[model samples]
Target chain A: MIPVIEVKDVVTHYGSRKILNHVNVDIQPGEIMVVMGGSGSGKSTLLRHLIGLERVSAGSIRLLDQDIGHMSHHELTRFYRKLGVAFQGGALFSSMTVGENIMLPLREHTNLDEKTMAIMVRMKLEVVNLAGFEHLMPSELSGGMLKRAAFARAVIMDPALLFCDEPSAGLDPVVSSSLDELILQLRDALNMTIVVVTHELDSAFRIADRITVLDKGEVLTIGSVDQVRASTHTRIQDLLNRRFEETILDPDEYLARLTGESI
Target chain B: MEHSVHVQPNGHIVSFSGEIDLENSPAARTRLLEVVEYATTVFVDLTAVTYMDSSGIASLVEAYQRAKKTNVAFVLISTSPAVLRVLQMARLDKVFTIHETLEHAQHAKH
Candidate 1:
């Protein structure tokens, strides 16, 4: 079977600093592939590349068999209809009610009747266990409710591929676990190929079919949860055990930075 | 998606094939509602339906509600596994009257 998403030897850079180094990942259909890494590990950058937020400096990223790097703006906009993204911060518009926020994508993309769209919103909200809260504003919801609302909005159109960035972040353990269960349920029911970028180990272990670990802009390892835990790599072990690695800087480079000089 | 209606002695049998998704679910909804509005009983055959999204399922839900109010018997005949999985996920399988064969659906009363 063909992979729903293929990232081949992708390289990305911000100015002169390299952020992603020859990254390659294959996400199969109907599987939850979790990308996890520490701060500045390029996991977020990879998510951005996969979702077409930013272009890779070299190589290609293919989503649903289409090379996103080569698509025109008009083509990309149309292509986005098949993909759903839930940002880390629950990116709901404060001006709109939860129902309207969830319906925004349908309103922008399809010509389905108003009643059908409304039902779709209600169905998604029901799936997220946020039924009857559609009329509430984003500001009126609690943190967990906001995230669930974001999930409902993300999945309103029943996208083929869903991306959730830090889905379980900024919530208590119970709420976080509930979100993990929601992700699994959505995948089982909707048959969506999901890529979730998170740093939360428990959440990752709960929902991931496979885990991809990133360090210093490169993929350190990709395997099942057991395989990852058993690996001997120091960085992987450090990340897993929550160990802080002390960095020792080169004297010349440190001096250059201290004096504001380009080395 | 392609839909055809067959007039039987019992009721109108509406068969839909291909993918019923966002683009064509409206047409499906309109046709189903029109049939249920007048017919005393309606049998929806989804044996050949390969794929159906939420919009298509919503169409079915709306038609079922209309049939309930109008005292029309609405039965789903031979739902494809793909459609059945989605319905089961939303727990709508318990809500709709479904049968494995037309003979069984025809014999059962609402």
Candidate 2:
């Protein structure tokens, strides 16, 4: 099958600093591609390049077999309509109610009437477990609720491609796991290409079909979670092993060690 | 929608018995809300609550949410395994303070 998104040797730079260098990834339709990295590792820059929000300095970016660099204005609009993006912080409109916020994209994109839009809104809310909170203002919501509302808005159009940035950020573990489950369901049910940018290891492993690990503005390693976990590349080993160590250790034992206790 | 409230020196105890279903939910919700208003802590006994549906669950959740908002310690007591299964399925088991018996729930408060 043709890849939904293909990036070959993509090099993105901001001024003199290279944000992404020689990065390559193939995102298949209906699979989730997680970009994993530490802070300032240029994962966001790569996403920006993929969505055509920022141009790559060198190399090729192809979506649906068309080079994004050569797309015309009309073609670009059509291209954007096929994809949905949920930015960090949700980025919802402060002036609009949650229902109105989700309805904006549908209203602008389709000719559905008020009743149809209301039904669509309720359906989307049900998907995200926010069915009755549609009438509530954004200010009335908590952090997790805001994220789910934004997610509801993102999928309102049922785009072919969906991108999420740090979906678990600022969320508790329970809520974060639920959101991961929702993302998995979205991918399975919608059959859309999902690209997630995040540093959370648990969330990444829980949702990713494949992961591209970046370090110092370059592709460190790209593989399934098992391969990445078993990898011996210095950086990958160091990162994965460090987290593994914490999970394996008993907290009380570790604390005792910190207190200089034997055994 | 029968409510039996036992008043003590410190607080009032409200015991919810029988089945909570769509038929009696609204009235039950109203009475439970009112009963929780005067108590420092409210223990809702669900052992005798033989049946519940989504509407019953919604009403119970609303009661719990309201009690939380009002700063009353809400205790869900004697949750039958059947009721616990429903709560667990809905992911509400983690949200509420549930116990196997009324005394166990009361002991937890101390």
Candidate 3:
């Protein structure tokens, strides 16, 4: 099968600093790809590039076999309509009820009337296991409920590609595992390609068919869950074992920085 | 419709068996409504229920509403995992009165 997403020689720089260096990944159709790394590992930057929010300095990103760089503005909009994104913080409009929040995308993109829209919203809520909770405000829900609500909104359109950022963050173990189960269900039920960005090791292993480990602005390894877990690489080992690696200081660079400081 | 109702000293104990789903929820709703109409209080025993889908949940909601409107006390007794999951997902575990055991629900104040 043709890969749903292909990234080749992706180079991204933030002002004078290089953030992503020749990153490459090929995500298969209906696959769950978990991009994981510690802080400042450029995983988030790669996500931004995938979503077309950040411009890559050099590379080609072919989503659904269409090169993102070659697409027109209208083409880009149409391309994005087939994709869904769930942000880390839920990003719900506190003003709207849960039903309205899930219905926002449909209202913006479709011309369905109120009744049809309501039925669709209910169906999506049921998929997320939040049925009969549409009228409640965001503040009325617990943290886990908020995340599920956000997921309901993201899948409202039934996008072929879904990107979830830190889905397990701030959730307890049971709730997190349930959310992971929901992600797998979405993939099976909708034939969706899901890319999850999470630092939670258990959650990643539970959902990911393949995982891409990013470290210091490069792709460390892209492999199956077993391969990534069993690798003997020091950085990957440190990350998997949750061991803190002592930062080795460069004596010459340290002396130069210390001497150059204004005193 | 595969259920039995016993008029206890405090309230009526209604026991439901088999699968309480889309097909039987209508009959369940009809029987449940009848019990809640005359009784001062009703206790739903779902321990023997093999399954309950969303429609079953709706039927219980209807019973709750009927009890609320007619001033009849409504309570759920002895929940099974299959039934409890749907209830909790709908957040009705907080909405409805629940008891750990059928005896507690049966003898407790309505």
Clashes of each: 0, 0, 0
Candidate 1 residue lDDT tens string, A1-75? 999999999999889999999999999999999999999999999999988999999989999999999999999
Better structure of 1 and 3 per TM-score: 1
Off by over 4 Å in 3: A243-263, B1-110
- Each model's TM-score for chain A is 0.92, 0.90, 0.90
Residue-wise C-alpha lDDT for candidate 2, range A1-263, written one tens digit per residue? 99989999988777898888888888888889999888888899888877788888999999878899788778887678667888878888989999999888867765544544665576578778998998899999988899999888887766778999999986766888999998987765555689999988889999999999999888888899998898889988776766677556687765564454756
Candidates in order: C-alpha RMSD to true structure:
8.2, 14.7, 11.4
Q: Fraction of reference contacts reproduced per prediction?
A: 0.56, 0.00, 0.00
Ranking by DockQ: 1, 3, 2
DockQ of each: 0.53, 0.02, 0.04
Q: Which stretches of candidate 1 lie over 4 Å from their true place?
A: A243-263
Which of 1 and 2 is ahead in DockQ? Answer: 1
DockQ of 3: 0.04
lDDT of 2: 0.78
For candidate 3, the docking band is: incorrect
Best by lDDT: 1
